[model samples]
Target: MAYWLFKTEPDTFSIDTLRLQKVACWEGVRNYQARNMLRDEIKLGDEVLIYHSSCKKIGVAGIARVVKEAYPDHFQFDPDSPYFDIKADPSNPRWMMVDIEFVRKFERIVTLAELKAIPDLENMPLVKRGNRLSVMPVSEDEWQTILHQE
Candidate 1:
């Protein structure tokens, strides 16, 4: 299975929230590049690293598994929803989402600084300069290297 890293603001939806809820609908992705990955690449059973971004303790907080594959992001169709897209049509969805189930929470965060310090992870998108896609693919080698830090 492929590996992925999904970034989220802790204040918005943290690893703790995922741990408590057990499963979460990973939605509201507005970027077309990220949306394409969600719709075309990510699949059920793929592992994920829940990375905390836009927060004080920014890092990879835990692991999750894609329990459900891509489906139309319903929020894009709800006028009252913040994620609503004026141009999105129900007949042809523009955004997609996946369902991820909490797998394990790391004992301690694998900090961004720590990740950047590792030579093996230098090629990882998350560690690259200015690479800010909410969803990013992680190579199997990168995945294992990061996990080893836990």
Candidate 2:
């Protein structure tokens, strides 16, 4: 199965929140490229690195699995929702989301600073300067390397 990394603001939805909910709809992705990855690449059973971004100590916090395929993000249709998109139509949605189930939280946070220092992770998108994709593909080697750090 394909591997991926999905970033969320810890204050918004942390690994603790995922453990409590068990499963969550990964929505509110506004980037076209990120949306396409969810719509076309991710599938049920795929593993994902749950990352905490836009916060102190940004890095991979836990593991998750894709529990549901791509579907229209309901928030995009709600006028009151912060993620609502006026251009999105129910019949032909402009944004898509997936369901992710909590797997396990890392014993220690693999901080972005730590990742940046690792030569093996040098090519990782997360380590790249100014890279900002919320959802990104991860190679098997990259996944293994990061998990091994735990």
Minimal lDDT window, size 10, model 1 = 123-132
RMSD of each: 0.6, 0.8
Tens-place lDDT per residue, model 1, 1-150, is: 999999999998988999999999999999999999999999999999999998888999999999999999999999999999999999999999999999999999999999999999888889889896999999999999999999
Model 1 error, position 90 (Å)? 0.2
For residues 39-150, could you state the per-residue lDDT of candidate 2 as single tens digits?
Answer: 9999999999999988887899999999999999999999999999998899999999999999999998998888888899889888898786999999999999999888
| TM-score of each predicted structure versus truth | 0.98, 0.97
Which residue pairs in model 2 clash with each other?
none
- Superposed by TM-score, candidate 1 places the C-alpha of residue 54 at a distance from the truth, in angstroms, of 0.7
- The global Cα lDDT (0 to 1) of model 2 is 0.93
Off by over 4 Å in 1: none
For all candidates in order, the CA lDDT equals 0.96, 0.93
Q: What lDDT score goes with residue 109 in model 2?
A: 91
Stretches > 4 Å off in candidate 2: none
